[model samples]
Target: MSNLKGLAHLRMSLDDIKSATNDFADNRILGRGGFGVVYAGQLPTTHRSACEPGTPVAVKRLNVNSHQGDKEFLKEILMLDSCKHKNLVYLIGFVSEDTERILVYKKEDNGSLDKHLGSTDLTWEQRLRICLGAARGLEYLHSSVGTEHRVLHCDLKSSNVLLDANFEAKISDFGLSKIGPKNMPHTFLATVPCGTLGYVDPEYAISGVLTKESDVYSFGVVLFEVLCGRLATVVKSKDEYEFLSRLVKKYYAEGKLDDIIFPGLVEQMKPGSRELFSNIAFRCLNQDRKLRPTMRTVVKELESALEHQLINLDDDEEIIGLSGSIGVYNGHELVTSLCFTTNKRKYGPFNPEADNRFSGSWDAGLFDGFYGRHGSYIDAVGCCLKAAARPKAQS
Candidate 1:
């Protein structure tokens, strides 16, 4: 690799990356970025001081068809080589060999947020935290740079967010990152259509205007997914109000915000928290880019919402008369669970250990919300062996 300018990529051979990835084996592949393939290859721990007893770094390879990835490789080495924002994917460096390129970051065991959200795996509360962390990462990127220079993650969604050992989110995929050009309008500009389908900004997707709002729009879709405990989008439109913007419009205009909320969440969640999410989701999907919340605002709102909804006051359960309920801890992820019965009526989880008091902590939503609403008067609030306390009825 020859250095053309004072600042150029200190290149490593792509053959090394290929060897780490086992010739791009399917299992080594972490995920598909917008245009490139992100591989979860590992390298020796060069930053030993920050490392634990033993840890290796992660590597991501660009796909051969990725025309745009070639440009992204240079930008990553030149721009993100030294910058260390916890939210942004850390770049240790890159490897380049003739036609192939590889970008490396710290390896994460939990993989992408996509694993948790897409599979029948993650609990609602876990998904909520994932959303908040991803939002904050984007928030930091948009503001961490100097005020004059702001970065926009052209593609923001669950898949691009990788989770480290402690489950903290780190945003990846710089191939679509669009930093505001100096001596140019930062407001909005026409560009080629980019980004994922469900998460894409409708206004931008239609007009080709890639603004900061486009990222916000994608975040809003992600927020909806977080609340619903599902992916934010689908290719074939599901319904008239399925588009996040329309849902927001209908909720504010018609005052039927509750209608769109995932019924499972509504039943388990506190009424106030439910309304708060609806309001924030409304703020994010503003049809006009000028009206949408910035990444900073979106992050704060989401983090605040997660705190509000997931907060556990064991005392509150007693007040609601749900001090004891029979439940499996983190029961929301169980797909084909059986309905436990009491008094000959099969409803909710059975309360065999009714004497035990429910300990409310971070992951109490399945008891409070999801599995809590199976029966008319049943609840999700419960200890591992006891029946959920029902203040009134769950339906």
Candidate 2:
């Protein structure tokens, strides 16, 4: 077994990694990028090195053109390695050789959100959940100044959101990500615009100035993608203003917002959904960053929307019992049937696996602000639980 070090304090021998990748065979390759290619490989676990357990991992091999980016890669790894949020991808280790740099990470099973959402395999509900999960991840990064490197996810889009077995979202690829202090305390200077074509912040695109607002704006484009089920950059027009945001805004202004929503959800969509969802989407898509709602707000609204979806609106006021099916948190974390959201203060974490087999670890309670609140929020959680209750339940 190779001697391993703490993340940031470690690097793997290139020969060992190369051997795992069979000297970099095409079949071993998992993905490619402007700066590198990721190969699927099995590396020696520091604890057990004999047979090479072949832990499923992605090995990011930096290309020759990334001479300067190599330094940036190291910096990115060191900075990101310390963050332990569930929403962010974890870096396993890395390898460096003469003009060669490779980063290793756990291989997410489902691949990019774009691969599933862009294809027909994903359902409308899944799309909504994944996007919501991703937004929270970004929100956490933006809100927690210490964890985030001041700047925002400069290149967020469907492609950058990787999904795991249960379809949870994990942000990946920090290549063009801007490093700044949070709350836009400083300006990020760049000579050229660096981001995916469809999701680039308009202001950043024209001025080469990076801000948290830039990331917010790009996230807006992603919101539109989630809603419209199409690429923002692909909205071609033979006339003036070929941008997807402009078109969406125009349609929204013309009261044709429904024309853009994904067809499958259109039929199942609930009342008052268009305005709320449209408003949320437009707020994210707002050209002026100041007008956009913070990621926390966006996440809450989406969660509320999902809650709205869980119960029967026609008879929602009455308390009801609940039952089984897949329940998701922020469209990413999937927990089994048992779930609860109470306004109970100081509620703690519940790990079902510790006792019962099903319902895994869940936060004791969410909605800290509404804790002990005597209103519809608490009532709703209770009422919904009653409506879907398994003849008995507790948080």
Candidate 3:
């Protein structure tokens, strides 16, 4: 354990952590899980660098009675310190003194992705981007992150994905992670199958053989959660709980997935995008682990899905005008409605509303297309400009 303290991560004192978190006050708690309670707090002064002296941070204090003990805590610290990627959560420091076990991470302002599962404010584009980011993070883990071993995120779920202020996804929670030789493709580790109820891979559970496919299976459940706007598991009755994976596979096979897709999200998805996203997600749930797509393949498919979502007008068409309404939703000002006018015809007044009406038009010049900033909603929008083609001279 002494060698762990010698690692590059800042070693924070328990006193400093207690002071920042007000001794883990109830009000400072961000969330709780099987391991322990997470508290919102400030970075200890001892570890201050380019950032402010007391920059905000998240502190996860391990519960004394948690099933996850010192071994898991130490593993998390080692795994996180070894793997570093933009999409993976950044470990600021840790406190492992006496009986206390705490982890400090850079604060993700938007919190976990699970909190916004059923939120109408989260647009389809945002969901796709979040999924893509998470896939990339997992790909890095499964491949190599400047390490000889490939890390397997044994527990993958929506709640484990943190969102930054820009809504970028960051994979977190590494206590359950395991590593294997990077060169092995068919690698398998015999261990107790342990993960969240709905997200656990069925094959892994039965065989007690864990592999990279197990993570992919969990990721598939998360993808469906984003599409369905709900958790992977829901209580149907006191004794019976419905799993999203089963429901997704059923709806997908019957070609009735639209019936279960989150409201408003379907309207935002192009047929190509929706089909591609759903297809890959369904494939990940394949009972045969050999048939599941690798994280690398998953990332490529998600990229294609995003590309399909963007508007691609015909060669002859150009934007002629725009109309939309801006309004506040849940305290955030966003473009609540929008529509496009082309030289050929009007497209639509999508998400149409009457609040704070606005419009713009041009009789000349080329309206290349549209561009804007978006997250939970379209925060702002602007038109692309290109010089109009002059009429061909008489031949």
Give me the candidate number with maximum lDDT. Answer: 3
Cα lDDT tens digits, model 3, 79-111, are 888788889998888887888889999889999
Q: Better model by TM-score, 1 or 3?
A: 3
Residue pairs in candidate 3 whose N, alpha carbon or C atoms collide under 3 angstroms: none
Residue 113 deviation, candidate 2, in Å?
Answer: 1.1
Tell me the TM-score of each prediction against the true structure: 0.67, 0.74, 0.80
Q: Which ten residues in a row have the lowest lDDT in candidate 2?
A: 368-377
Q: Lowest-lDDT window of 10 residues in candidate 3?
A: 371-380
Give stretches of model 2 more than 4 Å off.
1-9, 45-52, 145-151, 183-192, 235-242, 272-275, 313-395
CA lDDT of every candidate: 0.61, 0.63, 0.85
Native-to-model Cα distance after best TM-score fit, residue 21 in candidate 1, in Å = 2.7
- 1-395 in candidate 2: lDDT tens per residue? 12223553556677777777888899997778777788887775442332345777778888878633665676657656755566777777676667677777777888877666455556655666677678778877777647445546677887888898878788877766666765354446664777877688787789887777677777778777777777776634655336677778899899898887767767765544445556777887777767777787777666655444432333223212222233344565333333333322222121111222233233331211211111111222342233343355556
Candidate 3 Cα misplacement greater than 4 A, ranges? 49-51, 314-316, 319-395
Looking at model 2, residue 268 earns an lDDT score of 63
| Residue-pair clashes per candidate | 13, 15, 0
